[model samples]
Target chain A: MAVASSDTAIRTSRITRAFIYLFLLLFALFYLLPFGIMLVNSLKPLSEITGGNMIALPREWTIEPWLSAWSTAQIGVQPTGLRPYFINSLMMAIPAVILSTVVGALNGYVLTKWRFRGDTIIFGMLLFSCFIPFQIVLIPMARILGILQIAGTTPGLIMVHFVYGIGFTTLYFRNYYAAFPTELVRAAQIDGAGFFQIFWRIMLPSSGPIIAVSFIWQFTNIWNDFLFGASFASGDAAPMTVALNNLVNSSTGVREYNVHFAGAIMAAAPTLLVYIVAGRYFVRGLMAGSVKG
Target chain B: MGFLDIDNVTKSYGAVEVLHRVDISVEEGEFLVLVGPSGCGKSTLLNMIAGLEGITSGEIKIKDRVMNGVHPSKRNIAMVFQSYALYPNMTVGQNITFGLEMHGTPKEERDKAMKEVAQLLQIEPLLTRKPGQLSGGQRQRVAMGRALVRNPDVFLFDEPLSNLDAKLRVDMRTEIKKLHQRLGTTIVYVTHDQIEAMTLSTRIAVMYDGYVQQLGTPKEIYDSPANLFVATFMGSPAMNVLPAKLVERNGALHAVLTGAEGQEIALRIENAPAAYQSYKDADVFLGIRPEAITDPEGADRNARNIQGFTNGVTVTEPAGADTFVTMTLSGKDCIARMRADADVHPGQPFEFAVNMDKAVLFDPKTEERIG
Candidate 1:
């Protein structure tokens, strides 16, 4: 009986592992197909792309369109081939991520740990702001920005992102911090840790997942934004999203589909690379926040 | 001067006053334990002494110096938290030495202190491991080591064993008592466990509703409680209290114990308070420890005498070493701890002798000791 059971267990283990590998292989192809199509289309010449179906790879791969997308096309002709716009997007997003996450952590720390009055009202207000539609407030916000004379500048975009980013970041941190034992904070105080000392030494060190979550959220929100970029950006400060929109929607002549696809790929590359590199952190961050909170 | 003095300390959160005019003093190298139930401000008062909370309107002095505005570090005190708040990131060695490092001790001296405490706590092998990697007992010992390495003037422990399992709690309690005896440091520990307080404290401060109800040696708190709350709160199975009236019978005093169906058993009051003699039938409360009222054969002849009384058994619980018998006396429920050999049974009437010598009398109105 023992020999028969051992034989059955070994067979089951082999079959289970095979099934797992097949499942993962299938799942990978499901996501990679669209990215493959985008790459093949971008590398193809306009004549071949216009003549064939969407998913087909080009018979002859050429670097002309890549160069055109980088230099000669209307999308690329502005300010060192849309490089300044790429810089603008990064400049706006990094600081916004930093500021929002810092404010969020402090807000969260106070909301959960500090027993002061009116803290509930403040937390409620932050939660409520996350539900307010950006469409309803865009026009009034633009007008206000115009009056403040920061309507179309890079700093203005950063400030807007910072303000809008606080709601989600604060929620993330507040919920994350609620799981922390209050006894630890009291112990730190009794151990001679002051306010900032407690935050830096104890609270901040344990904040890896929340920081990753906040960073990813803020980066995606700021980098992928088109409506805000169109409304707020002009001239050299226009982000890559605005440039991508203008490239695809231009009505004066027949569209250069190859350059357009290349530009699209270029515009989407930074976020794609970020998602790939920090993908583990992204999933772990969300999972940690869900259960830990 | 006492090493630590708390004079008229009080605490209130907004409209709620939790502690009211609490006073406690501990001499140098004394181990004081504050024990109480939940919602008692024992933890709050300990926090106040550690300078984590503000006193409502009183003073706390350590070593003849006012500690009102001094920061916890400047006050030169160390505390072991209830949760054993080891720094999650630091290893056990670092957790024990972090305070010393903060106080700017030399590296060699810091390592020496850590080694000494680790050996003392029997945690030398766990020094390189983080708090998350250690067991509950290991973390507790590490917390103690952290507090000890500081060599503070006063060590504060806030329910440090409440997080452990029962077996580990008992083991740690014994270790803590032995540590106190060996080091003889001035320590103020807070716990809700009566056994822990009884076994570890040089003096136990019984707290209730934020005030120190009584402060004395364990024996004093056990034998002569200041009030009904302290009397009942300090003991296991608690003290048995029954209501009766003080009556005068023939030139001697007696307590009239009324039972069901108009059965009145009169018992002698040998050392009756002078105030009781004035009122012939004044209502009073008789407080007796569970061991006081027992079978006549099991009664200790040399125990302190209260007014002599007799009670009828209504239930019997034999606990091997001793039997807990519950009875109806003076129209209220009373419990007594008797010997296992005392043949007690429920539903059968038996009169148990009461040792009135150790009994305490309390005024019904104020719940304060009458004599």
Candidate 2:
């Protein structure tokens, strides 16, 4: 009986290991293919890219597109470069991400651990507001911003992004806070930690994942936003997203695909860098918050 | 003067009352336990005393100072929650010294207190480990140590041992009892586990339906419960309450019980209440504890009259040390405790004795004690 059992165990271990290796190899190919194609296409000259299939590597690669995207390029009569738009996007996304996440964390701390009236109703409204499309309110939102008299500035875009970004950030933090054992909060309270003390010392340090998630989401939303940025910002205050759109879809100009693609990559760079730096926190945040809710 | 006094405390959520008019006073160095079933308002009362919850219409005093609106830290009370409530992100040493650090104890004094508490709890070697890295028993000791370092006016525990495993719970229970004896501080503990109440408390307050049913020493509460609720709530396997008829026999009161074989047994009741004297031929409930009823040939048969009450066993369950025998008397079910060597068998009826002198009688309609 012992001999037969040992043989069966050995066979089972081998079979399971083989299955795992096969599964991993298949997933590796699935992920690496698209990235490889995007790299090759980005490096190739525009003539080579449009002449051949995307899978082929370029015989001649040039850095002119990358350099041009960083310097002077214009779609309108008044000449201006993409540099200011890149800086504007940076100004909008970073502050929007930071303020939205800070507010979300505070809101989460109040709603979950503190028992007060109408907390559930407020949370439900926040979640409901996140689901509404931004286009539905863009016109009214633009008028409101205009009435506030800060329509064509960086701060106005930051405020608009923060307002739209709060719903999702709160949803992330609130749901993450719910998974925490409430006993910890009570213990902090008993330890003489008042509202801000508990939030800053005990709760926020352990809140790395949720903060990363909230930042990434807000960063991407603000960086990639075109309609709001276009409606709320004009002239030199417009973000890199609108600048890249003008480069690609100009009403009547020679469309430079290389500069537009490079500019597009630049516009998407901030969120992508954020994702790389906080990659583990982002993954853990998704696993912890999204899986539960 | 008493160390702590709770004056006519009452709690209600909206229209439904959870705790009703509870008054208790604890002498210095006393260990008091409030025990009941789920939703019995024991935890609510403890929370109010801890200043974690506001009192609806009551006042709590610690060291002669009224503590109604005071915050928990200002009240000088430390509570150990059932969940241990350790800061998960903190090490054992940090958790123990958090309360001290908050109260502005100097750095050297805080370290001294941490050393003393860690040594007392035997958690010195676990100082660097966070709560999640420790075992359940270790976490429990750290929780106790957290409360110990404060040296507060009072210690409140809300079912702190309910989360431990069975063997750990027994070990922790003894440690808590020993700690009370050694430290001589005021403690108010709440639990639904009756054995914890019976073994650890200087006094046990039995609560039910938002009211204190009875308050007395452990022996007093066990031997002389105030009502049916107290009698049934305090014992393991519970007290056997059988329906019977009260009657007058030879100018004395007796309980008339009919056995399964249709035989009538006349059990003499001593010092019967005046209300029961007029309850002749009236249906009443007979409350008898398991220990009060014994085997016909048990050792305590001579000290008390083994014939004061008698019943026949219907089933017997031998639990290694003692046997529990279920019997039917007057068409009502009751349990009796017998020796393990009694040789009682299931489905075989055997004669058993009941100590009517210690039995309590309750009115069937109101479920209240006759006396």
Candidate 3:
């Protein structure tokens, strides 16, 4: 975007630009150093990693640890792998992200366009809920889960993440829709459209950027959350984070460092994929809701 | 009751009332303009009529049906908003017929109605283009087309042409007036531009500070204003108001004021209203339009009493077809309109003609017209 600007700003010498680029490149490589070490040690046998330098390239590359981490990594006294937990995380994150985003969009529509008495207070309370710590709700949530008799289930974990995530999603959507002209809603109402019809036709079509922002935010938070997963879910219902913790801890004596690296990378892979795919819209959507009057 | 009636309608947000007892009745095909400065409750009144804002008191009826507690969509009324309010995601054709589709009209019929409206608006070539891609004028046409496609009982226009440039505003004003003439649909338009109100409206309701200062035909509002507010608000170079005293000389009513040189000048008033008989020696406000005072040669030949006076010009502004000459009368800058070629300059004494027949008198105490 800056390259297209024909503005006459202060000019910099070639050597200065070269030094700036070199500094940025070095900082980037420094951040990537841990990931580089993890990647190089994940492919070698455990014996080689123990005897050799961890930063060095693989002496003998093999897929045995990858296969072991995916299946047969002895996760919690059972000869199971992180694959089922990965699937559990996906199932939990997908529905929770979608439900929270949709409900938040509805909340945003009503708060901005169809405002009623005490709406600002309701929105203020929703925003206040976002700052609440997860530990504060653990006891009450556990009690509710027990009463509902679905404690430690995948649905229960999804419910926990969903209940906690809607506040943030609503905040994003409300600010974004605040800048949307209220005249369009009034015009639609006069055009014989009802409440939900206006929302579906007039509003949702232009909500692409904000929805992308909400989806990326909710997906990242719910997938990376370990506290809620460990507390609300158990056994085969554990998310990938809990399963990976079990895989590393349940191993006795000789630590399979190579398999641990593989399992850790596997747990972080989905979030990495999400950011790589939709990260461009994160800043764009945030800016859309920020700079508008 | 007329076709659309706003009967003693008042809108209040809690304790503060923005609109107070707005009573306007429009016969079929009558174009009533609700015009005022911003925050004068003109738009609020338009919204109340459109059913967008609920009325706190009184009632609004369309086609003689009471519209209280009725939803906007069920009111069968259409409004063209100030921003145009074209749906950004829909194309021109779809935007035009969205209301019809929402009403469960068949696909083929919706398309037919859309085409007819597009043809009427001469936007047939732009049907597939989205609103973001269209120019400002074209988007305005599509907005009007959207309202026209519905064929509702009453059309409410809330400053629709204000978003355009100066030239486009004039052009669209003409187009709207033409549309009203062709369709003969009852329209309640709102605007702050007084010229639009005077030109397009069959009757103009001039508002100020949440009060309807005056309501009458454009000519009536121009020639016979109800108060000082209407007289000053309805004209471009607003009607000049000079403080004067009403006196009786030679057994005829006369308005006596000071000239530019501080000399006493008296203009005889002929055919005065009966109310002036009681205001013999009381102070009064004399209102006269710019065009009513012109060069001796440019004065209206048909005027019954064109009184000539000599005043020193303080300013001369050449405005193409007419030259506006300003001078001090009764210690106020009184403007006189003359032909562009009138040899007028500042610091020069010139003979100006005043058409006393067109002059209006207001009571100094109440500011209301004397008769």
- What's the best-to-worst order under DockQ? 3, 2, 1
Question: In candidate 2, what are the lDDT values of residues A161-234, reduced to their tens digit?
Answer: 98888888889988898887777777777778788988887889788888888988788788989988988888
lDDT of 3: 0.91
lDDT of 3 by residue, B267-360 (tens): 8999998999889998999999999999889989899998888889999999999999899999999999899999998999999899999999
Could you say which candidate leads in DockQ?
A: 3
| TM-score of each prediction | 0.88, 0.91, 0.98
What's the lDDT for residue B115 in model 3? 89
Task: Enumerate the chain B TM-scores of all models.
Answer: 0.94, 0.96, 0.99
Compared to the true structure, candidate 1 yields what TM-score? 0.88
Q: Is the docking of candidate 3 incorrect, acceptable, medium or high quality?
A: high
In the predicted model 3, the residue pairs found to clash are none
User: Highest lDDT: which candidate?
Assistant: 3
Candidates 2 and 3 compared: the better one by TM-score is: 3
Candidate 1 segments exceeding 4 Å error:
A1-36, A61-67, A70-72, A76-84, A114-117, A124-156, A250-254, A279-293, B259-263, B304-312
